[model samples]
Target: MLNTGLLELHSDCQNCFGLCCAALPFAASSDFAIDKNAGQPCPNLRNDFRCGIHTELRAKGFRGCTVYDCFGAGQKVSNLTYGGRDWLQAPETAGQMFEVFPVMRQLHELLWYLREALAFRGAESLHDSLKLMLEQTLMLTTLSPEELLKLEVHIHRAEVNELLLRASELARSTARGQLNPAPKRQKNYGRGADLIGAKLRQADLRCVSLRGAYLIAADLSGADLRHADLIGADLRDTNLSGADLRDSLFLTQAQLQAAKGDLAAQLPGSLQYPEHWSVKL
Candidate 1:
């Protein structure tokens, strides 16, 4: 029921808590050559609460810092939940702030998907279903911190899955049931090509043209998409988890944050690795 076209439903990080910097941890790896623990501030975090090395994070050996997105949870939790108080100015709120960060992050992730689900005209048949889910997700935002943190996300996600499958069925009908059908050979695309819900996991989609493509809910997890051209692409809810997106051109930070990516994922030079992943530590 929110305005879906303008991405208005998503978070604006500039107005956020800088929660991504404070809540997540980092380690010495290709992405970040440090061993900062969870909930600790980055050394480069500035007095004004911005990353001091944001522009040169890669050269500074913090590559993962360039690719991370909190889906606007950072700003909302920082400003709304804490009443515009930064942790440095109110040190006593540290524990509570960290605890609330992940809850808001999870809520924002659902919002990203719900917003995407509402945007697909191909899924208009399932709009009512998506509308209900969106309403439920919006209600979660108003819950107390304890309730929000204790919330079971998989239950709501399961409900969304049923509707998503039906939406895929409707979208696929237009694609003639061929998911990820090879694009034309000469750097071009035909009018009304459908790629919605296609399984592109680990696919080699380098240097390809995807103008105005419908990529809603497409599983791009683990795909090597270096240098791919994605101009005017509809990428709502397309998974990029575990995908190698290094050097992918013209992909915006807003787009990357709108999709899901875990620790196993690779990102552009601008983002960093997620500190919350439970790898074999």
Candidate 2:
């Protein structure tokens, strides 16, 4: 298996420009009660790039802000990539930074899963391909600012399709036969089942009905969860590292985003990495 420990690298956020304050948007929801547009600095953002009402964001109707994470993307681009520059003084650099930020974020997210995939013993068969992909992705980070901004990630994704498919097979195989399909039963009955601390590592749980199940602190590492239905499931502190959650049903953006996963972590394909994690190594 590939070593994923090295992919846990992070940037010092204190020196960052608080890009998350500017890059992300908010909608009126349980987490965020206000609507903010992209590229607009959050009202609570101070001149020093700290949230003025950080401690009271939840009380002040901005609970979403407290849970949001840039996955260290804010720091990586705001600090190392740009040498601590900001759009404030250098307005001309704003466009470039904005374009590069998302790209870098995606790369970092990919790094998270690639690293995690390598760490899974069940994925050993595809280690060589994983290594190549990881190295190539590492090289992308070194591309020129213009090149990085203009990178055609779709092409790279296409190139790795085979590897991803193979890795999925390997990862899925590890979870063989753990979960049985339940009869098409009434929804209200399964509202709150106790699944905490279940030894469900590497289990194939795709398309399983787990709505409103108490999955708190479940050992779900390396589980194949593509297209599974997980609406209203309590997933606090769940160990979902390296688990495939792409296309999983009923997983709202708010729930998945609020859930915690390490950099070198994986989520359903439908989910995006929380901005706070630096890289998914």
Candidate 3:
């Protein structure tokens, strides 16, 4: 399969059946304005399977929806798995479709990471293995709903994470060699650290691994995050004004959407500046 095909793994809301809004349950919390039950269509969901308040979700206190990404699983199940049929069209199949959507979503997320791992030139030695894993993941995405529900996705994810860790190490090691020598004290390693509301402004985080770190409400303004791996890092309310994240790895749109930043924050090309961000540097 073509590597470019992997790009389609991103969400295509127009082609989706609003599976997330319908299948996932949410409570009235800081993220959502109202409680929604599993398999129930969200109140804002239109008959066309589009959000009635899509442009104003944040303003309406539905920020949770804005940060959610199904990794293209919605369309894959709506069109391919269910053959373009929807819950309304085929009520009998609705239950199984919802069950299968989350499973497919997990598989698609793995595909996203595997594709990124394959693109890491620093991990060239692991290219063959990465490609093999990508192929295996692609095969899983094509499985029927029955097969997908039977999948132990966590087992495969653990295996892929092993290779991804190696890739991360190689990439960071190479980046470190290229950076100017600095005092050892400036080095920061906060992998899986509880850094919520921690003061980290202007910190030297270059070539660091903040994977799965809880950075919510952390002050990261002007911090050097070049080549940092931010996969699964909680960035909500983190002040990123002027932070240098130009080459950070595994930074997704959802993470960026959840965080607060200004125009001066340098992001990788794969991501776009949030429109709500302040223009001030």
Candidate 4:
């Protein structure tokens, strides 16, 4: 099982310096209400570093903020990297801090995935390698702002992803055997498949690799998606009512927010149901 303590690595906005609301620039689009430049405090960001309209973000056309997760990067940079000094308190260091935040966020995201991969008992063969990579990634998160700015996070991510993919293959292959003991062949669920508007209601997708699949507006109501690798899957407007996704891999809060689900839809413990979901149950 995943170490429950690792959950602390997730975003805790209360402990952050509102980096996401300030450092990341967003264009005025369907997802955001306004175009904001990088390093500029969001108009809705309060003096206390909290969103002024957090509760009504989606209703107020700031749905992008509702989906953003920094994986505890904000607090790590705010407290540890800068000794709890905020941008306003020390203007000289603000630029460097802002630049470091995104780098830390990417590293933390990789840590999240590696930690999840460590929980798979079926992937015991890759555990040692995963642990080593996790340690290396965690170390990167602790680097100084200057060091972080110099780091190439994508290169490190590529190295870690190799082990994660192997682990996923092992776990999914094992889950496939356990879930379907029969020798019946399954269709190739292609990577990056353009599954837009595909009707997949009640589909047996257990242990399938749906990585990078375009599931936009797909009708997946009541689909059995347990153990499916959903990394980078575009779930916008996908109907997941009554679907089982308890063991889905690499599924993130942003993807869930972009999709629609109900109380009857089973999600993994790491993810929460979006409040905007229309169906009660």
Candidate 5:
């Protein structure tokens, strides 16, 4: 986590070893143009470690590539953990590097969310604990490849998640209306619920838990998602026109990229509008 002056927790391909392309596997489905096994270099991966189809990925039927976010794991594993020993130059570390990449990705994702919850409004009481967990997660990423592979990330994740849930509850409670009275919230969102193509336009979803929900192709136009926990929610093809997510919890760039959105939608300050989102809104 040494400062590289790059936006930490965001992908910076220039400092990476194309680990995602070589390490990740994808099937020949709607997202991918072809099937690729783990550790196999994508046919489109160039000698310089840049995607050959960078501009044409979606057009070339690799739509999934466009939505994928490594959350800075590529550069971290390549530059920091492995000490810039790329698979091409070192060769022997390739397998271990590939294995470690996903582990690092998960740890980094957790770090991102912890930091989010730490800064969230009305979550001040949990700040000390959040900072400690963030530091602990950061220290885990510095372990050797073998150590990283052996690490039981889920256990750490569960502990962190419990803390995060408390933070979420605290933050959301502050948003609960005492005077003017906010809209009656939508129902509690179970993880991985099938919400594909469900009509939910203009819904009041304040302070709800949409964690790991499948919101693919769901119409969420003009919905108010303030304080909603959206970690791991599949937002692919979810319409977000005019939706208010300015205070939503754990929303990632990949989610926004996978979903359809426009300028009219408000996002958390940390997130930027996806390039594909329409200016017309």
Candidate 6:
């Protein structure tokens, strides 16, 4: 396992150009107050690159913005890639910068998981492979804006995902193996299966795959999710009080931010309880 921690995956907005508020388009809904086009700066963005309503996002109907995670890609693009170039000052460079932000974000997100996979005690044998992929993904984040825009990120993601799966399986197997006389686990769910609002409290979900699962508003309070893979799982409004997710695979801070959880939700050491867990938008 590499010595690097996941702290770098946390977004540092002070060094960013509000790329997410500019580069990503959003439809007006519960998450956003108005429809905004891609490449357009959000109206709430201040000239200094800070959210105008950062402290009042949830109350202002922009709860989505509060949870948006760039995985440190914003600062990487703003400082490392562009050398502190302010997009507003260089109109000619704005387009390329905006285009490169999402690509860099994806690479960083992959790097985040790859780094976590390396730390899984049960995946020791896969550390070398995970390290290589992590380095490769990190290198991709350093490409020039033009090159970044042209990268076949989806193809790269597919390759990295294969390794991630192997690592997840190894760790999950070890986790479940530790559970002597384990309880029954649901086996029918697949990627993106609809489980919205389903009552799953106290379910034995260890060593299962909830990848890309639509678990919106699901009642998962007190669920045992040890080593369950949660990659791409939609956790918005999911009740997670008392859920055991300390070893859950590939769970990101963004996922936790989207879900409804409390201090009782056992999270991986690298994660924190979101401050707005009880705030209703």
lDDT of 5 by residue, 205-238 (tens): 8888888899989999999888888988999999
Alpha carbon lDDT of each predicted model: 0.65, 0.66, 0.86, 0.87, 0.88, 0.88
Top-down lDDT ranking: 5, 6, 4, 3, 2, 1
Kindly report which residue stretches of model 6 are placed more than 4 angstroms away from their true locations once superposed.
1-7, 278-281
lDDT of 3 by residue, 124-187 (tens): 9999998889889878888898999999999998998888889888987877777787414554
Which prediction has the highest lDDT against the true structure? 5
- lDDT, model 3, position 211: 93
Pairs in clash, predicted candidate 6: none
**TM agreement with the true structure for every prediction:** 0.62, 0.61, 0.95, 0.93, 0.94, 0.94
Q: Lowest-scoring 10 consecutive residues by lDDT in candidate 4?
A: 1-10
lDDT of 4 by residue, 134-240 (tens): 87887777778889999998899889878888999999888877875532465777889999999999988888889889999999999988889998799988999
For candidate 1, lDDT tens digit of each residue in 13-120?
567656777788889987697988779987887767777887778688886775565667777677666789888888988877887888777666666666554654
Lowest-sum lDDT 10-residue window in model 5: 1-10
Specify the poorest-scoring 10-residue window by lDDT in model 1.
Answer: 272-281
Instruction: For candidate 3, give the lDDT of residue 252.
Output: 84
| Candidate achieving higher TM-score, 1 or 2 | 1
Q: Considering only N, C-alpha and C atoms within 3 Å, which residue pairs clash in candidate 4?
A: none
